[model samples]
Target: MSKPAKRKVILGMMAASLALTIGLNPQQADAAVDINASASILVDADSGKILFADNIDDQLPIASMTKMMSEYLILEAIDQGKISWDDEVSISDPVRTLSLQTELSNVPLRQDYSYTVKNLYQSMAIYSANASTIALAEHVAGSEADFVQMMNDKAGELGLESYNFVNSSGLNNSDLAGSHPEGTDANAENELSAKSVAQLAFHLINDYPEVLDTASIPELEFQAGEDETIQMQNWNWMIPGVNAGHEYEGADGLKTGFTSAAGNSFTGTALRDDMRLITVVMGAETRDDRFDETEKLLDYGFDNFHEAELLPEGYKPDGEDVIPVTGGKEKEVSISTSSALRSVIKNDEEELYVPEVSLASELLNEDGEFVAPLEEGQEVGQVQLTYEGEEDVEYLYDNQSSSTPLVADQAVEKASWFTMSMRGIGSFFSGIWTSVSDTVTGWF
Candidate 1:
């Protein structure tokens, strides 16, 4: 894929950051974006850190963005050999009914026609077609209801606590016209927090990057030269110079959603300089506001924050420092961190931070010495990174503020009683000999 147009924009921003280094301090350089969204969040796709958030946990209707889960399941089925891209999907009566509804966004299917999985995926990802999403759901799980259950199950597995999936496509329960699936309530609508949606976007992009292959197409032939041939264009306007008037440089796409119940919402991802950020905007005032707020959120992240490796992998803080064991075959046990520690910090303040390693209290007695029958790979403490000169460490720390575990590098087995007694006797005699030698020296 060609590089996003925002490469130049990001370079310029970096240059500006350098110039600001001469004029503004870190505190002055930090400026927050005020968005009109009812709920919004920006996340580092690589580190899963939240850079900016406003009412991020407030659950709201996500509209067609719910189709992201449907697309995920479809791609999974193909990967598992349960289905193939070329496999044909027969439209059901409900799917045909959805196709005819002028109120809903749909690909307009016919009962006599059969569409391939690839075709349906493209329609759902690019055009946000309601009928195509439901069709794919039914084909994959035998019913839209079962497919929705799968979506909910996946959400739970992902640790998503603030989401409820009522339908494969995000049509409101009322919009479904009492077509709500068997296990769901008649008035149910897919609901999730902006942060939860960002988490979903993170999983979607990382797990099924193949979704972008369909999402990036500005326009395509849905049926190619057939009587019902339809031209589809991506609704996401952030793609630089796409049909959407505002050209957001790195906006590749994820999904866009809107409905009467759920205001304009979007889950968008953009990449610049190998750094990808995901933004979720829910209940924006207008269609354009969703993209505009997303742009602000992305700019705030790219301009103010960065990801850095605080410590290298397999980092040993106290090299050759061993912890003493009370009863062990060995006198001491070795310790080290299992992996590198990564942190996100202000782009301009990366140099003023210091990392601290703290040993476990349980390993120490009153004199603060390690006492152990230590087990290998046992977690004994934590390594934390904090700013050196900053007055407000809390403001700078986030998910990246997390600690790496300090673990035992080697085990120390319990010692035998005879061995312990021999050492005790040797120490007593050595002390008596030292006292005699001191007295003889005094007489001389």
Candidate 2:
């Protein structure tokens, strides 16, 4: 990706940092993007590090965005051989009624006809078809109620908190014609925090990258070249060619949603400069506002932050460069980082990273020293990165810091008894000679 014209200016002030000669640091860039929404977040998709966050943990109605969880389960079922893309899913009475309502997002269906799992998935993913989603869910789990349970269980397994899935399609329970999943309030709707939503999207794309192949499609034919076909346009208008006026350079996916309770919301991911960022905005007042707010976030991520080396290969923390080895030919073995530590960092905050060393106790002797016969490239411990900046970073995964291995740089053999005796004798003569020389110099 070509660097935006402003990139030169962003890095122009970094010259002075070069003189530090210790480590590379990012220079502060333009002010952070001001998002207009109830909750929003920006995250590096790879490392899961949160670059920006605003009320990200507040649960709010997410509407159709809830389908991400359903999509995940569907892909997982296919992966596990429990279901296949070519498998036919027969529409049930409730699903057929829902599809025919025309008031909700859907593809019309007849009870006598069946649709392939792949087609229903595409309709749900690209078109946000509510009834298509329900059919797919029922096909996967035998019933919509069971599918909702799977969604919640998968949420728990994915470490998603502040979330609830009442239905597979994300329609308000009332919209389900009182046929909502069991135990849910009639008016209940699926809800999730921007953070949790981003996490779900993160897992979805990573676990099943092929989702993007379908998500990036601007439009598709529900049943192309058939007697009954519905052309569906992706709700995500930011996609290239979908809306030339609103296209973001790298915007590809992931989903857009809206409901009376849940304002316009979007979760989008883009790839540029070898970095993929996920942005979530909820409660936007207008359809354009969600896309506009998403642009600010994507711009902020691309302009103000980048992937940088936190610690270079062979990095050795201060005063922890060597490990003492008892009874070894060498008294100590040199140690250094076994691998490079890299992560997404905000511009102008590069110096805030500090490398910390942690040792593995199992590899230590009674004296807390390395035993004889240390092997080269032997991993003795791990080195991890920690940010010292005032701002706290929230990772999409477990919010854990990045880490690398710490290993011995060279081998250290055990000293033989004969070698130890010879070394002792040599030391005794060396000490005597040094004392004689000191006495002669004093007499002079």
- Tens digits of per-residue lDDT for model 2 on 1-444? 458756776676566555453232222233446788999999999889888888888899999999999999999999999999999998888888888877788889877666899989999999999999998999999998999999999999999978999999988999988889888899999999888999999999899999999999998988722488888998898888798767998888999999989999999999998899999999999999999999989998998889988888999878999889877899898889977888888787788988888888887888889887878998999888778976666687774568888998999899999988998999999999999999999999
Q: Relative to the unseen true structure, what is the C-alpha lDDT of residue 172 in candidate 1, on a scale of 0 to 100? A: 85
List candidate 2 segments past 4 Å from native.
Answer: 1-32, 326-332, 371-378, 397-399, 409-444
TM-score of 2: 0.82
Residues 1-444, candidate 1, lDDT per residue (tens digit)? 346767877889999988776354443344557778889888888667676667877789999999988887888888899999999998988888888775687778887676899988898998888988898999999998999999999998876758999999998877777777887889878999887888888888888887887787778778822587888878888875465476787778889999877899999998887788889999998999998888888888888777777777677765534666675678777677788887666676766866677888878777655665778898887877767754344311244454688888888766789988988999999999999999999999
Q: What is the TM-score of each predicted model, taking all chains together?
A: 0.77, 0.82
Predicted model with the maximum TM-score: 2
Error of 2 at 64 (Å): 0.7
